[model samples]
Target: MKPRGTFRNTALALGLAFLYLPILSMMVFSFNNSRLVTVWDGPNSPTLKWYAKLFENSQILDAALLSVKIAAMTATGAVVLGTLAGLVLVRFGPFRGRAMLSAMTTAPLVMPEVITGLSLLLLFVALEQLTGWPEGRGVLTITIAHITFAMAYVTVVVQSRLAGFDDSLEEAALDLGAKPAKVFFAITLPLIAPALVSGWLLAFTLSWDDVVISQFVAGPSATTLPMVVFSKARLGVSPDINALATIMVLVVATGVVLSSVWMRRQERKRRLEEQMARSDAG
Candidate 1:
């Protein structure tokens, strides 16, 4: 049993090491002063020059900013659309074409990204030819494509939450002369806020990291960070790539830390409020 336990621990360590070693290496290499990525001169090799160079790279910064803008827009649109779809599915009960709606909403989760990208490309081309609405493909096209896929994941998140939601809260609001919209706004929306937030974050992450869909829908005018990174990677990994990745790692880590702290504070505040209410009741 001890030997088995040791073996399990060793396996877990190896698994984690394998997953993180590349990231660790990237972080270390990002600080290297030398332009060549593979060279390890000595202990004093680490420097902040790459980070400085990264900031000076206007094209990479432009691409990163474009990606962020697209992600933000896509996440917001996905949340709104997803919430409406989820509310319809969960609250409205069995309706005509309910099965079809549900199927379509979940299909993106399983569909290959390449296939989805191709279909969206065809769709945008058709729309452009037929109406000339978009005229050309760029940020708007990329955003719409992202929203199309991200909305599916967001819908699933919200729909699952709504499915498990207690009907009593909304019913009570309605029983006390609240209209459907009022009840949704005052009661249901607040209750499902966490799901909405999760959905938005999920959508944003998907949009931010997407390569294939963006590649298909993106015009020459709107190059995304991932595309820039992929293009650079083809010529062999550069120190700038390492620096950019290290910065992203820092940003993600900071976000996680801040979010965890905020959640803990919120939890504490709720508990304190509960205690005060209990004291007043007594």
Candidate 2:
């Protein structure tokens, strides 16, 4: 049992190392003074020059800003639509075309990115030709395309959360004379808040990290961060890129840490409140 436990621990450590070593190396190299990203310039190698240079690069900055805008819009739109779709699937019982709706909501999950991109490109072109509504592919097109695919993921997340939900609370609320909308806005929404948050974050990440779909839908003027990064990387991986990535890593790490701390505090507070209420009752 001791030997097996040691082996398990060793395997876990090795797995973590395999997953994180590349990221660790990238973070370390981001601080290196050498322009050649792979080579280290000895003990005095660390410098902030690349990080400074990253700020001066207007193209990267613009692309990053554009990506953020698209991601925000995509997440918001996907959450709204996906929530509705999930509620329809779960709350609206045995509706007509239920199977079709479920299939459509999840189609993007199984669909190839290339195919999805191509299909959307064609869709935008056709819409432009017929109605001239979108005019030409740009930020709007990119966000729409992103939401199209991202909503599928959000729907799945929300639907799964709702699936295991007890409808007794909702029924009780109704019995107590609460309107359906009121019940949904109060009890239902609060209970599913975590799933909604998760889905939104997932959708935001999908849009922010997307390259293929953005490539198809984005106009010449609306270059995204991923597109710029891919283009630059084709030439060569630069120190500035490493610096930019390191800053992103730091930002994401900070957010995760802060969120975890906040959630922990909230949980503790809730438990304390519950304990106090129980004591008062007793």
Best by TM-score: 2
Question: How many clashing residue pairs are found in candidate 1?
Answer: 0
lDDT of 2 by residue, 209-281 (tens): 9999999988998999999999999999998999989898889899999999999999999999999999995
lDDT values of the candidates?
0.93, 0.94
How far out, in Å, is residue 212 in model 1? 0.3
Residue 189 miss distance in model 2 (angstroms): 2.1
Compared with the true structure, model 2 gives a TM-score of: 0.93
Candidate 1, after superposition: displacement of residue 219 in Å? Answer: 0.6
Pairs of colliding residues, candidate 1: none
